[model samples]
Target: MNTLNQGSQKYDVAYLKQTIIPGKTTKGQITQMFGAPTNEELNSTSTSNESNWTYEKTDEGLDKYMKLAHKYVSTETSLKMYETSAQLAKAQTVANDVSSVTGTKTGQSQTQGSVLTIYFVDDVVKYYRVY
Candidate 1:
């Protein structure tokens, strides 16, 4: 399967909520449930080394139609579609502006993905955050 497609896979959020307990859950269980983390970090503290594991899922597709629409459509029309003027302006800028450094148009639509991060100290879960 294409791991690149975030919407293609299903994650058990409820199960994660029930299982991930700070100070109780171990790194092994986390690895078993979610497979290997996408990223890992080592943090140094006064006492010992701490570890952070991040599991991320992203869904990205080229928004060709939106790009085309933005290029052809008027600002007034784009404003109606966007929620705010700032958003419209940013969209237009991204779609149209050529980067002075890269010399490439920098417009693309990307939906932010969900991230699960577990912080570990002494081989046990110290804290976790989901965003």
Candidate 2:
């Protein structure tokens, strides 16, 4: 017999969002304040400013996994983005480097937003956030 217990924890996206003011803050600054971000972007423009910085705090899900004896897969519960012109510039640089290395196209048609998806197979994490 298997019993499941999901432990509760505090998650505040608003508080995280409050840590920085977009356009004024850089990705480095945001990371310094909030630690390494799950993701980072650079060289993008925002309505408020010409650049943006973003990060996400994902639930580790270990607690839930253990509770269910690793039987269940979880999806992202929440996500947030931060804006900074400096960060956007940096992200653009990094993306350029990646494209150069992979011989991929320099620009994507969709500039507004990027989507990430994670795939699993046989109850194991396979690939994630493949754009």
Candidate 3:
């Protein structure tokens, strides 16, 4: 049998658009919705002093497999069961060995995460970008 498992953590852009308004949303409101930012920076420009808040998210994928094989080695071995007792013995030996052999294989993949940068002016959201 084979199996696959995938996991991820991310932000909702549409939800952000609805919740974060350029002139109305405050730093406290953004923090409430997204938790603490991954990183923060302050900038002083000719006309404005602003802050940049960065948020990040990641995704991962995985694949798993199981393999099994069995072999029976006996002096009394035959292809026709009813024709000979040797065939029955060989069949029994194979059935007995079936539980002893097995193997497993696993594979994994990952994707680069998404990043969102929110620019704040006077503690209010000025603009944002997602990549």
lDDT of each: 0.64, 0.36, 0.59
Residue-level lDDT for 23 in candidate 3: 86
Off by over 4 Å in 2: 1-13, 41-54, 59-131
**Largest lDDT belongs to which candidate?**
1
Task: Report the candidate with higher TM-score, 2 versus 3.
Answer: 3
lDDT tens digits by residue: candidate 3, 1-131: 11232212224456566677898999998877677777899886625679999875431122111111112323233233224545766886665455334322211111223677899988898998876
Per-residue C-alpha lDDT of model 1 across residues 18-99, encoded as one tens digit per residue: 7788889999988776777779988875376689998765413223344456677799887665556468778767665445
| Cα misplacement distance, residue 19 of candidate 3 (Å) | 0.8
**Total clashing pairs in model 2:** 10
lDDT of 2 by residue, 1-131 (tens): 12221211112333323543433544455445544434434333433223222332232234334435323433322111122434776998888788878888444422222232222232222333322
Query: C-alpha displacement of 6 in model 3, angstroms?
Result: 16
**Candidate ordering by lDDT (highest first):** 1, 3, 2
Clashes of each: 0, 10, 0
Worst-scoring 10-residue span by lDDT in model 2: 1-10
Q: What is the C-alpha RMSD of each candidate to the true structure, in Å?
A: 14.1, 20.4, 20.1
